[model samples]
Target: AQSVTQLDSHVSVSEGTPVLLRCNYSSSYSPSLFWYVQHPNKGLQLLLKYTSAATLVKGINGFEAEFKKSETSFHLTKPSAHMSDAAEYFCVVIGFSGTYKYIFGTGTRLKVLA
Candidate 1:
């Protein structure tokens, strides 16, 4: 079975500080991992993805994550946080075989303190 666990349900950060959101995943085979962000009442946007290809993956809005197979983790990070970055983030994993269904973590809510 494939699953993902978000380490934090909520993270609070100042506008200019760095941001970190931790995630752990378990898979029976090579898994596709993704981070998605959703603004208030808005659609989910892809932050980054880790295929079998890249270890260090970068995405939009100055966000990035590193796929660590040994650690079984993919944690999202940003050099600097923005007020607009205040939103909800979900750690997702795609099933290894059969129907390609998504497994979403509970979600981490980012609160940007101005």
Candidate 2:
């Protein structure tokens, strides 16, 4: 079975502080991991993806993640959190079989305090 768990349901940070959101995944096969950000009513934007290629992946808006095969974890981080960065983040994993489907983690809502 394939599944993803976000360690935190919500994260609060001051305007210029660092941001960290944790995620863990389990898959039956090689997994393609992804981080997606969703603003209020907007659609999801791809933050980063770890194809079988890179263990350390960088994404847009100063976000990045490191894939740990042994720990089965892929955590998202940013050096600084901006007010504009407040949003909902979803950890996703695409099945290795190329099924074009995704398994989404519950979600982590990020609040950037001004």
Candidate 3:
């Protein structure tokens, strides 16, 4: 089975500070990893993904994540947090179970404080 876990349910950060969203995944086979962001009442946006490419993947809005197969982790990070960055982030995984199935994490709500 494949699953994803968002380490923090909620994260509060002041504007201009660094941001970190932790995620860990478990899979029986090599999997495709992804990060998505969702604003209130808005559809999900693709942040980044890892699929046997460079371990360090960059995304929009100065966000990036490193895929570590050994650690079973894909943690998102940014040098500084912006007010607009406040949203719900999700970690997703697609296991090679002969079909396309997305395993979504519970989610991590990021609060950008002034």
lDDT by residue (40-108, candidate 1, tens digit) is 989999999898998999999999999999999999999999999999999999984567999999999
- Candidate 2 Cα misplacement greater than 4 A, ranges: 96-98
On TM-score, the stronger of 1 and 3 is 1
lDDT: worst 10-residue window of model 3: 94-103
RMSD of each: 0.9, 1.5, 1.0
Which has the higher TM-score value, candidate number 1 or candidate number 2? 1
lDDT of 3: 0.95
Off by over 4 Å in 3: 96-98
TM-score of 3: 0.96
Instruction: List model 2 lDDT by residue over 1-114, tens digit each.
Output: 788999999999998899999999999888889999999999999999998998999999999999999999999999999999999999998754455789899999999999
Compared with the true structure, model 2 gives a TM-score of 0.94
Give per-residue lDDT, candidate 3, residue 68: 91
Sorted on TM-score, best first, the list reads: 1, 3, 2
